[model samples]
Target: MRGPLVLACLTLLGAEASAQEVVKIGHVAPLSGPQASFGKDNENGARMAVEDLNAQGVTIGGKKIKLELVAEDDAADPKQGTAAAQKLCDAKVNGVVGHLNSGTTIPAAKIYNKCGVPQVTPSATNPELTQLGYKTVFRLLANDNALGAGLANHAAKQLKLKRIAIIDDRTAYGTGIAEVFKKTALANGVEIVDQQATNDKATDFMSILTAIKGKKPDGIFFGGMGPQAGPMLRQMQQLGLGKVYLFGGDGVCTAELPKLAANVKTIENVVCAVGGAALDKRAQGVEWKKRYDAKYPGQFQIYSAYAYDATMVLVDAMKRAKSTNPAVYAAKLFDTDYEGVSAHVQFEPNGELKNPAMTLYVYRGGVRVSTN
Candidate 1:
């Protein structure tokens, strides 16, 4: 009787183990480059979602589901981004949640689409990303269209600047935003005094600033990231352009901007636009940020909340579809109406966020403060 009872318990344990399914979600970002801070923050958000989902003991298709995050480092390179995407597809991850920059995300989107893997980008804002017509690609926030135009409108109407110089890193994101800002600023009767170009990895802007200084522009609009923006700010001060207003898109909008700028006084002159409402303004955002800070401390930059929402959005689709298979659940993303920490997650036919919000911010006393 004792031998029979022991055998029965063993058989039941084996059945329980077989009834559980493991789901892998891939997260790709520039985890080892100048943008690593932003990448880490993005990864942290997705990881937190995975942890929370597991804690809730989620089930799909009547089987217990264990979520796993498989992160990849694209180093902010387009080629590496494609490689990372292919690797995830080969690994057969159920979903994807990153490739933080537009340069990386655009190329990676093709690979994910080809493999039929659904990808949600939390931070990449290039309009062309969704324009590719890939059904598997989705954006979690407003695109460069909103961010660039918003900043241009503020510069021309709110700040009432007359002449502005433009500088872009020349990546897809940088160039796209810079062009929109230029066109909008010109239409608003603001003069584009000078136009210059730079690469994302460049650190020195002394020569460019020296040239633009001669133009006597009232402001400078830069389309790039915080790492380049920081050194450019210092160079601007060194070249006696400290009093000039500095306008930028979401690429330059980050909590680390002050630190990256080495606490420069020029930071106070910066006005940048981000693609979401101010996190501190909403009840849901406020609470979500509190939980994130407790878990991640000072690592918060700009896109963590969006990344968290993206991860949750993916899981919501899986749960609704009752399956973790990409082919089975990919279509469910287009129908997503999940309430997320960032916003009520919904998508247009082109995979762009529906009714997205944009916020402007500035640095005061070395801290990021929202202007809207």
Candidate 2:
């Protein structure tokens, strides 16, 4: 499902600003497939931030300013992602807020860097994205290295699962995190029974499970999107894969996973890891949900809050820099420290989170509960 999209109409509304230079923000992410909910959720959050900032008459250099979003669909494809970035560059947008998948975000990073458009990703976790020495690309979320190490440590020191099998979706983020998990797990004396590969769009997992079952692994580690993970969970359950846990990277943090797993029989015990804000129904999160529900009902997805924060951050930097020129605003971004829905957010010199933190989650009785 594509979910509810607050589609960006690309209209220019800078009348109140004395500067009269319209600032355009570009957003490109997956708006289709199993991860569609996530991309749409982020788009909604960005739209809210843009609307909020534009309504405030935010001024720069004695000129009122308007923040406008120009949205594009990456379709979770790297080529499409590069195309989207190029389109934004061609249009001369001020900045960007997306490229959700690391595989897509990584290649698109070079394009954004080449065009000098600062792009901050909300959810891509591959560490190599920032390791490329491209200052134009930033990741607000924690990287896969942290996530893989966290889960690996937990499995080895806490859960003490001796026999582990690792699997990857073959994407950049997937492979990177899985390799980290493998090395960490091995370092902790956990035996690597099997390692497998799967594609992001794969639905049939019987052969993989067949191979893994033969090895008698205590647990399975997957580094892929929730669409594939949910089905794999169902297959494992149906195949009588007992006492085996399913762990994955942030690629599995979709709201639709539970429902997807439920549709297939024999999927109950499943665990997942996520890399973004897990609002605990607090008043702040509740209020955000209420606003989102009022605007777009039953269409919530992961990383929306991050996307919102990213958009607001760019707008804030633009207002501070007092110019829509990409060069000036890009420089001013380094000077920003804003309190966003995600956290008091800022970036380090490497474009990673200043204090990178992650949260672990599990599906309990059909609801995602944060276990810290």
Return model 1's CA RMSD, one decimal.
1.4
- Over 4 Å off, model 1: 1-7
lDDT of 2 by residue, 28-69 (tens): 889987678778888998888888887876777666666788
| Each prediction's whole-model lDDT (CA) | 0.94, 0.81
**Residues 1-372, candidate 1, lDDT per residue (tens digit)?**
569889999999999888889899999999997989999999999999999999999999888999999999999999999999999999999999988999999999999999999999999999999999899999999999999999999999999999999999999999999999999999999999999999999999999999999999999999999999999998998889989999998889988888888888899999999998888988999999999999999999999999999999999999999999999999999999988888888999999999999999999999899988
- Candidate 2 regions exceeding 4 Å error are 1-20, 263-268, 281-283
The best candidate in terms of TM-score: 1
What's model 2's overall lDDT? 0.81
Model 1 poorest 10 in a row by lDDT: 256-265
